[model samples]
Target: MPFDFIFNFLTNHSLSFSNPSTHLSYFGSRIICYHLPHNSHRNLSYRSILFLLTIDTLICQNCLLNQQLYASALLHSKSMILLFSLPIIVLAYVLCRNIKLYYDLHRRGLNPQFDIFGIKGLMWLDSSAAHENFTRMCSVIGDKTFSVLRGATPVVVTNDVDLIHAISTEHFDCFHSRIPEVLSDDPITSENIHMFSAKGERWKRLRTLTSYGLSTVKLKLLFPTIETCVSEFLDHVNSLSNGHSVVINHSHSLFQNHTSYVLARCAYGHKEKNHRVNNFLGVFSNAFGAFSDFQKSTAEKITYFFPEMRLIFKNSFVGHFLQSANQQKFLDYLLHLISRFRSRTINENNNKPSEKEPDNYSLLEFFFDHHNEKKLVEKAEGQIDMKKVKVEKSISYQEITAQCKFLSVAGFDTTANTLTLLFNFLAHNPKIQDRIFNEEIKSHSDKIDFETVCSLPLLQNCIFETLRLFPHASPLQTRICTEPLQIGKYEFSENIQVVINPWGPHHDRDIWGDDVDCFRPSRFEKLTEQQRKAFMPFGVGPRQCVGMRFALLELKTTAFRMLQKYVVKTTLPVNDSHGKMVNMTVRDTGTIWPTDKLGIILTKRNT
Candidate 1:
């Protein structure tokens, strides 16, 4: 319609001209006819037409530019969406694969029943069944590397014997035991020189010092003290048995008490009465309970996905009560004992006018003498060179206290637990127990010396069997890899922690026969030299238990004296309260002890 309007207007206004150029000029002049209409209305009309054409040109250019920008923006939006979504898609696929692997492993019966978390099993194994379950899990997994729940934290479990050997021996420096932060938060942890607390140089020094103290010569020197403690323990037991049936929680009150007295006299030069209430035994028992509880709680919390809850839960009444009362009381008592010794030493030194005063024959005194002599040697060497030098001595007040405290804590409990379990085993297996008794009696009628007791083959076998079936510390010994270690087929990187389950290895079907769980002392007799080496009840290599000889002596003497007078028996049904024994120690509660309470029916054996 616009085209028709333009044509009609042009045709009606047409003025014919001769040449084409002349015609275009004539049309241009006629198109501006509105401006030359000889009136103001015509001029206004011409300006309106020019303004409309300018606006049209600007609008068309803007439309074309906007179309190009919109297309480019759409392309960029698509690229960004793809880039961000790619990672999510990959993550989803990986998660699905992991879940599938977990299910497949489970469905194939390759999963350990106790490993509920699929990472590491629970941190606390308080039952024999749990121990058994863990062993089974390791066997089924049979992999160089696998994961299990240590409470909530996932720990990678390895059955690589090479790794175990490396950790136990080659990489001993890297694989030292870890002391939980909670335990170290208090002075008790700091001042205790127990094997658990000893690490690096401090550990090395204390270990060397204690090793000397527990040497064959020192043990012989300490024989009388040990005998005295054991006699007292036997007397206590005899007094309690009135020819009637008696219930004995030997692990808790009796054996633990006796061991405490032995350590007290042998290590600290103090002999506290074990039978009395509120003595060292009582305090130690309370302290141990507190320590165990604290460890369990810490292990549980740290393994949790949300470990920050530990801080919030720290204000709980039980937590505060243990820290303020039990822990603090133990520390205060230890510090007081250390102070008393220091005062005595100071007075003795002051009283001696002569420089050649003979040293007192106490462990503490010996330590101080050596420590001072070391300082003197260092000072003399420095003076000869005219060099300023500082000599750090052994037996610092703190070191002495820590070492003594460690002895008191570790020595007593572990030995007591072992003895108690052994006793329980002897009580149930009267034939084996009686053989040990007869051997002890034949060795020495009145007094069984260290050498005599150590010679009894039957007694040694019994002890070895007890240690194997009911090791005090059940889990495989752990060590961190300090340097790269090659054990057998595998290589472990430095700083990775490795654990060897002694219980697992001891009970392994490949190593032991199908009757591995049976209480058989004769297994030792059948073992080849290689097998015997593998059966390390007290561990192996340089870092083995320092006080093993002392522990054996104590066990032999205590077992001999107890058995000579009494025939241990169980009056209660064997399986009635078997559950309580699970958390007690690694020993077999049922086989070693009767169910209700450990009833040792004492009968006077006429010599």
Candidate 2:
């Protein structure tokens, strides 16, 4: 009891002691006494004794640590030096890399760099004012090729036909892929990647399969589907006319409806107007915002600006896209179709699919035939996992969904707007309309077949000329240099975007003579071989629109037939609100639309 009491008394006294004072020192040994304050420790309970010991231990440790810290602060350590230098090193590296890029592009690379830098080039994403500005600047610089900034990214914009051919064909390997859209790298989000966004082997595989499937021979399978839709659309217009010329309000909407129906039949195999049919039309309209000006979602904008943030923004960029309910449904609907395709093709004896039906051919099914897997479609009854569907040698479910969705929409705004421009032009210029009809369509036959329309040169030239004047895809046509690309004396670095406005060459006086502004289709005849191949409305070379033949077939056929039936008539002058079709060009995010509703009259011919 005495030992315990003594121990507790001394420990509690140490806890209340002031800083230790050295009394005597000899060699390294020293006698230090901690002077205690006159304090009371009357509570002699076990808990009180334990608390005093803990406090005394902490005070002793604090005194030792302070002395060690004082010594460390005076001596320079390697870790401390690194801590101070790391940030500066990183900043210097970035600055040096940018400086090298500038020297490589401007001085050594012979690229005439424009002064506009920073966020000014983000106009390409905004897709309007900046684009128009770039087009104007092309003239100010007075050169066919120049370098500009797309939000600090270097973009080599060119209108030189010879250089374009070299990049697109002669030296395609140097500039094959496009700049990616900064999508999620989530394996499941691979569904959002399409042929346009793919790189390397994936691009080649997708391109090969789709190009063959969309060939003339393969597309012939869907001729009846296209024919029926086109005929029905014409009939609907006839009904709306009431046996007289009628100004079709918002003609693009009519074309949009027609495109939806076409996709419903061609992509989903929905022939009838079934309300519950899986047309996949709602997927675009409800989910991705369809033909209208689809403002990018906040998640999309964030991902685009900060691509490294993809991990955080993955869910919003692809797969379900919860921000839009229809996006989930759209993907699920495609998987369901794949499930059904599996059931019909599979022999039911094993996991592998069986024989394919000879007539089972559609844009969506074509992809399934070429590249398909079963896991994603496991839950045909409900939503299924988007991942776990990777195949060793074929395309995936998302690729099929994305590519077919792209093919289906090719006719919507692009084809529709082209037709809109064509009809409007014909209505304004009666002489041109009469000449085309009397010379091309009527000259062939009262009801010309598609094969016959394809042979008509005059009608083709008119359509080509209209596309030249308003190349909707001009602003969107772009390619990322894959390697060091050299065209004549100039060279480009990898990741440099080879862009074109098309508005330049298409309207250039040097290229098209002084009558560049004139409504002349005959200029195409005078153009050289290279100049003739330069009319790239759908883009140029191998990377051109996969649905080009299909779109062109529909365009030429529809234009020919429309001319055959109705004489395009308009009472409005050349420059009314919608009358000035040229001024009404409202291009946004690769879509060319008009500012207001387009009003054009379709007068039935007295055939």
Candidate 3:
């Protein structure tokens, strides 16, 4: 009775006024609307009826067509969006992978305590701060070596003596050239190849060629020229201070002028009549000021941080040309000297053998004679091996002129500053000054020959002590690692950079003892051979300063002259109003010089 009631209810609810062309039926709960003949459902039996269910409504054709169109459009839009986003997804994945790889590489070594960004590495941000920060880290961390990111590049800084000896001397072949690897072969950068920046076979040739010019024998030959300058210098000072202690403002100026004169006479063959010392001085000062712009450039700082940055700008239109008017004047002066030398050589050759000519010539003239007489390929010591003298390329005029300019730059500031600081040191310590005068100056004041200058033990120690306390060259020496080498427990790869801070070793209490910070001249006498290695004022190894003898000679000569004349004392400040005698604190420029004028009371020595 319940089934019959349900069927009657469905039949009554279903529309009776249906079209004859259509029939309604149900399969489970789903309704099906179909077109059929008028008696299509009449043949259906009770068994069929039991299998089917009642339907409530018929499906519309137009509504189904609209629904299908909407679904297709939605799918197409989704596909287009996904297609457009594929490149972005790939880019993101690649970026993430590289960042992770770099992070892994960066953490491999001993890192400093500071977590600064790339700005610290960009040394132009603050060079003194950068050097000081690094020195501080080395002191605080107390490690032989540590890694730091200078810009994007990673470098290892060390003060280990064994490692320094290995790289600079024992394994010298593997690490010869400096970093920020010579990217440009253009004239602005490399046309004039000097010893300091030369590489490989060129470096060997230049070194061998220039060595004799600064040789012990050559220095002896040039001693008279240096003595003349020292005498002139002493006379100049005497003229200025007529039996009174005068406030000499530019102590550096007098020394600089003397060095310039020495270079002009001994290096350039320019006699007093043709001398261009004043002209050279003006050009050098201006040129040095111009080139120092590199220390402030972002690009150069980045290059200092990452040597490989050279690769990025190697072919760029931008250039590092020396555009200063002073640079042009210097080049012109060199040209003029070359022309005069050539004319003189030609005239001398044309003259008869009986003709009398002055035999006095300069180191540069000797170089010129060698260049002309020698063949293109000459046997010289190899960069790595002393025993194996390899055939090297001949030198050129460009190279010689380049060397002259380089030497002038290298020696001027260093010698001038050293002389200034030496005087300052002697002024502050009158006992040392008296000992130098009594032992060195008085002993050889009349003679003052080469041997006499070299014979000053106490004065030499004072000079050495001043050098140790304030070195002209930065304590940080940067060298490119040519081959893979292991330092202590760490392994370094080829083509990487290694920074050696001599300051760390020089100032280390453990190495130099408790009195390391004090300016004690006697410290040198007590230092062991190993301890002595820590004092590298002129650097070390094959790349040690070619002009070391020249610089030391100049320093000794100046100090001797000053001590011979004046019993000096530093003029202390009166209640901090007039300022301290001279701020012993050094301004860390390309060379180290005092911040203030070195004021001294130079009482004329009782004759």
Per-residue CA lDDT of model 3 for 1-607, tens digit only, reads: 4346546655664575353222333323233223323466566543344334322212334467779999999999999899988878856654564354346445555443232444444453135434345567766787777765555555667777777777777767767766533344432245466777666556777787777777887788778878877777677777677566656766667666667767776777666632224776776766653222234445555554445666665554434442346666776786777678778767867885553333345667767766632434432122345335473535677787777767766777778778877777777777767777777678564567888888778888989987776665653256766666665566666656677666566767777787666667877778888788888777768877788888889888878887887787766532211212334322323444555566666778778
lDDT of 2: 0.62
Query: How well does model 3 score by local distance difference test?
Result: 0.63
Residue 261 alpha-carbon offset, candidate 1, angstroms: 1.7
lDDT string for model 1 (530-600, tens) is 45655766666556777789888988887777776666765444432222243432332111221223544
lDDT of each: 0.55, 0.62, 0.63
**Order the candidates by lDDT, highest first — what do you get?**
3, 2, 1
lDDT of 3 at 410: 75
Off by over 4 Å in 1: 1-130, 143-145, 149-163, 173-195, 243-252, 290-324, 344-366, 369-395, 489-491, 572-596
Q: Which stretches of candidate 2 lie over 4 Å from their true place?
A: 1-100, 110-117, 184-192, 274-283, 288-326, 332-361, 372-396, 443-447, 574-581, 584-589
User: In candidate 3, which residue ranges exceed 4 Å CA deviation?
Assistant: 1-117, 124-126, 129-131, 180-191, 272-277, 289-294, 298-317, 320-323, 344-361, 372-393, 573-589
Q: Highest lDDT, which number?
A: 3
Worst 10 residues of 1 by lDDT: 378-387
For model 2, give the RMSD to the true fold.
9.4
TM-score: model 1 vs. ground truth: 0.66
Better of 2 and 3 by TM-score: 3
Tens-digit lDDT string for candidate 2 (330-408): 6577567656755654543265466544345677666665665533321111111223323233567767777755555
**lDDT score, candidate 3, position 506:** 73
